[model samples]
Target: MSSLPITREQILRVAELSRIALTEEEIEQYARELTHFVDMLSVLDTIDKDGVPPTVTLTFDPIAQRDDKLEPSLPRDEALAMGPVTSDGGFAVPKILGGEG
Candidate 1:
């Protein structure tokens, strides 16, 4: 394997900074995986990308926004009255604590 740009110490430091708890085995495994990834990605340096236009995106704007215009819509009071539970101006939902209360 090529010399690894990352070290176990660096990995440990990152984990500590991120507040992540990893076991010794996990740290060793990640070190090896990261080293391999760096070595593999180094092959990209050999590519001849001269004068190649940088790719902006693989697809055009996926979400299209239409021009804003005034349109007929339901009245506020009627819409609120349709709901079984309504608050001051919106829907009233049960209190959720730890996903359930």
Candidate 2:
């Protein structure tokens, strides 16, 4: 509640920094909405929770996870066969860092 109200200039500046184009009406709308949101959050400051414990999660059960296992891979020759170019038993690609393709 002690925080200063949001301003149109602040909204416009934020939109400019984000590279967003906003109309005059849109800027006013966002300024009002952001001010309302902050006011609502400020209400939390008045709550009394002296004996309450912070909640981490709703459930304590261990999460089920699939076991990691190695599987057979495709043969190199067969894999290279699908490529447009092949060289030395592997797929051939153009050199990116520079020299020769």
Candidate 3:
């Protein structure tokens, strides 16, 4: 809402939260993109609104959800057959990052 728009500091903070490291050029690019987004929101705010009700979605109702019915599943041996590796009724995977296998 502030006309000051997004800053490089804000971009850096966002990148940190997302666990991403950005170069100086990337930080400047993201700041510019965020500023443009704010400008678009500002333009949207200037449109006339009379009798329009705020709706979360254009659809009439929430998208229909599938019924939660459990069906027959694969037997343990059958399921394990498709896995790359398996242990006692569980999947055994290769070493994950930063840990020994």
Off by over 4 Å in 1: 16-19, 60-63, 66-101
Candidate 3, 39-88: lDDT as tens digits: 77887677887888887668777799878999888888998898887898
Model 3: how far residue 20 lies from native, Å: 2.6
Expressed as tens digits, the lDDT of each residue in 1-101 for candidate 2 is 65677999999888989989999899989998988888889988789978899987676787777678887789888888889988899888888666776
Task: Quantify all predictions' global Cα lDDT against the true fold.
Answer: 0.84, 0.86, 0.86
Report backbone clashes per prediction: 0, 0, 0
lDDT for model 3 comes to 0.86
* TM-score for each of the candidates: 0.49, 0.44, 0.53
What is the Cα-based TM-score of model 2? 0.44
Candidate maximizing TM-score: 3
Q: Is candidate 1 or candidate 2 better by TM-score?
A: 1
Taking all chains together, the TM-score of candidate 1 against the true structure is: 0.49
Residue pairs in collision within model 3: none
- As for lDDT, the candidate ahead, 1 or 3, is 3
When sorted by lDDT, best at the front, the candidate numbers are 2, 3, 1
